[model samples]
Target chain A: MASGEAILAHGSAAKRPGSPWLSGFVAATISEIKSLYREPAALAFTLGQPIVLLVILVAFDFHTTLPNGKVVPYLDVLVPGLIAFIGMTVGLNGVLFPLSRYKERGILRRVAATPMPTGSFVVAMIVSRLLIALAVTLITWIFGVYVFGADLTGSAVLLIAFATIGSLAFIALGILMVAFARSEDDVAPLMMLVLIPSILFSGAADRQPRPRPHRPRHRYPRPRHLVRRRDHPGRLALQDGVARYE
Target chain B: MATIPAPTRESASHTAQPPALRVANLVKHYKKFEAVRGISFDVQPGEIFGLLGPNGAGKTSTLEIVTGLRDATSGSVEIFGIDIAHHRAEARALLGVQLQESDFFDHLTLKEQLEFLGACYGVKPDTEALLGYVDLADRPNWRLKQLSGGQQQRFALAAALVNDPPLVLLDEPSTGLDPTARRQLWSLIRRLQAGGRTIVLSTHYMEEAEELCDRVAVMDRGVIAGIDTPLALIQQLIDTGFKREVVVRDATLEDVFLHLTGNTLDGVSLDDARKED
Candidate 1:
């Protein structure tokens, strides 16, 4: 209790030469990464679920017929879809749950009391979540390419660009969901309402029933088609690279 | 000390140095309900000011507004001389706040939490010294969730001081602490004041107010019922012919408890533990 001078000396010695805004960004990003690492359940759900699905598909020896009537292993089609799904889940649930919990627990209000700009805090969160999503996607990609011999002839750089863009979009949507969410309790059900259907019909899953020969196919662009379409420069590059597999 | 009136803007202007904190006609409206109704007070530098109130007395709302966590419907708050509404980031740089319900990042160790907060202020605080100051130096690697309630409260106090701010606001810092821990916190507050830091805290414990506060404002129904030194408030009641029916004891139960149990917190001297380490 008599260490007042020690405290003061440390306080004076603590000054770091930098803009607080930049340091705040770096600190918050590190904090977010630490938080994500510590949550085993969230880590399992986001990263483990996709790899588990991939293993199940490979073990079952699933196959699909392309439009040209050539038979191919389903892993070839599913890997890209799974990579996109990783971005979606990590961007959506990863950002949504923690941000909601933080808001509910008054952590956001507490951080606001500091010199850090609110914008810096939020951007740091988005950036850290993006890093996690991209890292996991890369890991899954490597597994598909090496273990299963999945054809990703897609430009790795283009794949990454698309993944980054797609994850950012989902991250924005997650922020919007957080704004609309009443509490942390509301976030899980809201995420399921979006996640369940996206998993089933977005072509991100193996058992999604193919449209019958006489049935009218849905016109809306599924996530799989969004990545495979050859219009935009990034996706076109990806399509050209992936054309051999098709 | 008996007749020291609450400092107004006019009186404050005459002083050589500005008050550490100044609130003027602060009002906060939450849709249809008014949480704070035009309350004003000034805390001079290096003094402990207490806000004593019952639940729903607008203490938290006023504290939030002063901390720039919430917007006031109408009023102005100045920290040292900087206007809070206009220069909130600068105003915040001078403040160390411990909220009523403290929460932190989920997975960070105690030291990491302090370091992160310090980085937000562009400082590299001596986390070991801060943790030691709070008697949690031995548990620097423990996450917030691993902490007991009293331990978490102490850590919150440490986190608030990471920036070495001039003015510290603690909302009910000792609400759930056992007597020994509470006394330890009181001495820490005194040490902080001795270090030339201003403190503003809210508490339901009248004894806490009497023991530490230089002056206190009793708030009720979103407005201050009275403002003066704790002794002056009691003297005014005695002048009004109010008297206690029960005889006063020489020492209260808190004193008895502290006497029976040694004054050391957590049954061990943390300083000694740190040295042994």
Candidate 2:
């Protein structure tokens, strides 16, 4: 084949609006998923760790007394918090470790040398990590409901919305961490520095769980429910803007 | 004949149709170090261009700029008439890069790896043909790490051709290979040039530069020291009263070694699978 013809055959495909980028995203996501499956360790870390934590929380018969004098199961609160934690772990390791590895081992350099846009590659990464985070969220939610008998008292959509937003926020933070770090080794401490605090403050596994009592005056901070409460206004405003634009 | 056009002025457009690759006054400056200082050259279509330099001589930096991996501090690179600095994606469409390090997802088989890369370019690779060309047809299901150094380099070469790019950039394609492996890679590169692709390779091996490159650019300290065909460069030196202290022998030690030991690429380690070629 003529050289120009060869280039033209592939070049035209890349010219399509969003298709090239979307293909890049899809390729990256598929490759990531495939690689994750191949790595039992990575799979255990991303999927199994959260499940193991849930199992521990359930196996221990953990219960916390709420301020409303009702005893809420630990699974009920920890599951949601774990959703954010899932976001943290998946987002952090997903983007940061892989990105650093790619940069170090020349994977990023190899791909960057191609015609593929850097923006698309990054977006693909975020999308792929978000996907893993979403999978974690789904598995945990299912585990919470059936396995542990945790009630889905709130709207499922709202849970997903909060989880999605939390995951995105963590993913963004992971990118920031990557920017600050020089190598893959440097990311560990940096990740822990940010990761531990976010998980603790977000109430995924806080030290304190409010005890039950007939005290109407006291408002105890619920960690798991905090995601919905804190993010509900932002979600509402987003919906409002979308409605206004529509 | 592909003449070495005098280094043109920065930012000036060529009167003729643009070459396959043109790098003019390219410079790359890190915080305190200048990686590439104002280097300029053009690659004619269908020629095997070589950049000969030591480590940290800015050859890779220059190629990276043309490939759009790193940004140039000042100046421009055009690939097939499209300015890479401005029209990167378009320019990138015409280029393929095989880096020194073989960077493949370890878990992925060769076919899957090529499929992923092809998807990145929004094209479906003819995987069978690519594998066949790289002489890895029998080992399509092999993971990257399972392959030997030579096999990995071959796989990388296959990956570079997934898009059938007209301009292929190979950065030290045979860096860590044994002599046989290096020769196999050189033959593969020659086949690429035979297939009408313009290849720009970077290497420190004098033999590799002399044997494969149509023209060689000798770089030092981020600058182009000289640019010419290997024959012309040698001829110029000979005309300037330069003489070799030692007599050149027709049968060298490398040739004797290859003759005593069969020149066949050792593919036995890859699951007892021998290459078809």
Candidate 3:
């Protein structure tokens, strides 16, 4: 009983200690990361999928012809595309499914009853997803560079920066989807509707035949357009330097 | 069967401390329907107050408003003199809440869940002490999903106390428990009262309300029909010439069941029973 009284006294005395919101954010992020680690499906999707894609693409030995009749290994293009794909998957599926499930199962409500602010919970979700996305992207980049001798030639810092921004953008989109979704069940179909088109038009696979002369390439959705544009400038600069040296 | 002396309303009112909870004409409207129709009550410090009602009688809604989960359409709720509407975080710091359906993070073990909750409240709780308090010391590594229904209920109670809050709100804590489990929960709740914490619980079970609550407000149609001690409520009913169709007996079917089957809990071992002996 004395201990109980002491606990009550402490609880009353520690009301809203400075930076509870920050601690709440950190706890939530750690919890989310732990949850992600436990789910084999999520790990396989975010981490394993990209490596498998990298291997398959590299094994097929695809090459893309530049406008100047220079043939470059498709790994250069595929790596950036894989990075973008990883960001999109990690951001959308990562945030959307978990957030919707938490909301549907009253986990959000349970946490809301605590002293933590709702904004911190959402921000933590985004931060955890972004971390996973970055880690997966880094792993893919390393594996591509070391194993198959895929020529990166671009600055790693720029690639990481692009990945970070791309992941955040997709995470925001995921949050937006969760806002509209009524339950966890609603998220799957909605995710597919957005995801299928994004992947098909992302130019990540580039399996589509080159656009006919009359048809505009820009008309089709290029969700990975920014990723490709960011990759090209650095690669083109490096290739120009190689031509001059030769 | 409570070992601790129950605080009388008279003694509670004489204290200089403010009520643990005070609700004044609280109203909650959901779109087109009114859930709580302007209810008002005060729960004295150290009292186990019960909100008893049938389904959809707005007990959950009222508790939600008091816990700051739902906003009252009108009127005020004060927790230990702090207005909840204006200062929800401060009010929350003094309160521990257990929702009807307890859903925790999927992957965390029981100890991890408690620690995570403690971190949310800006406290580092004694996880061992907390787990032992809930009779879950032996299964600290078990996840919430792995626990039986009864164990989960007790764990939810422990989770509520992570910050060692002065006031605890439990929404149907023993709703789906077996008879033995329900009795076990009742004893644990009495122990909580013995520990000098104020408890506010909602239940449809009259026996639970009678067993645990010092004072109860019986709600019907979103309004309190009566508020008094269980003894007083029964006396009031008896005074109105209310006669039972069946003869009153000293023992109920629950007692008969307990008599036939042993009173030991589901997971506790015979060695543990011997230790208790």
What C-alpha lDDT do the candidate models reach, one value each? 0.79, 0.75, 0.79
Worst 10 residues of 1 chain A by lDDT: A231-240
What digit string (tens of lDDT, one per residue) describes model 2 on residues B1-277? 1236443222123446578898888889998899998888888777788999999999888888888888999998998889988888788878888877649887789999988888777777777777776678777898988988888898898898877788899999999886667777776787677666789999999998998888899999998887887888898889999998998789977767666654445442211221422
CAPRI band of model 2?
Answer: acceptable
DockQ of each: 0.41, 0.24, 0.31
lDDT of 3 by residue, B1-277 (tens): 1122234665366667878998888888999898888888888877899999999999999999998999999989999999999998889978899998759988899999987787777777777767776678788898898888988998898888888888999999999987777776776677777667889999999989998899999988888888888998899899999988998799988778766654466555333433332
Best by DockQ: 1
Candidate order by TM-score, highest to lowest?
Answer: 3, 1, 2
Q: A1-78 in candidate 3: lDDT tens per residue?
A: 123333333233233354558888888999999987888877777788988877666554455645554545567667
lDDT of 2 by residue, A87-195 (tens): 8788888888888877778887777776667777888788888888999899988877666556557888998998888888878888878877888999899888987
**Which regions of candidate 3 fall more than 4 Å away from where they truly are?**
A1-18, A66-70, A205-246, B1-7, B248-252, B266-277
Q: List, in order, the clash count of every candidate structure.
A: 0, 0, 0
Give the distance in Å from residue A144's predicted Cα in candidate 1 to where it truly belongs: 0.3
Which one is best on lDDT?
1
Q: Write the per-residue lDDT of candidate 1 for residues A1-246, one digit (tens) a residue.
A: 333346633234378888668999999998888787788887777778877877776655445656565445567778888888888888997789889988888888888899889889889989999999998998898778765557676698998999999899999889989998989999989888888897888744554423322223435422332323442222111143242322
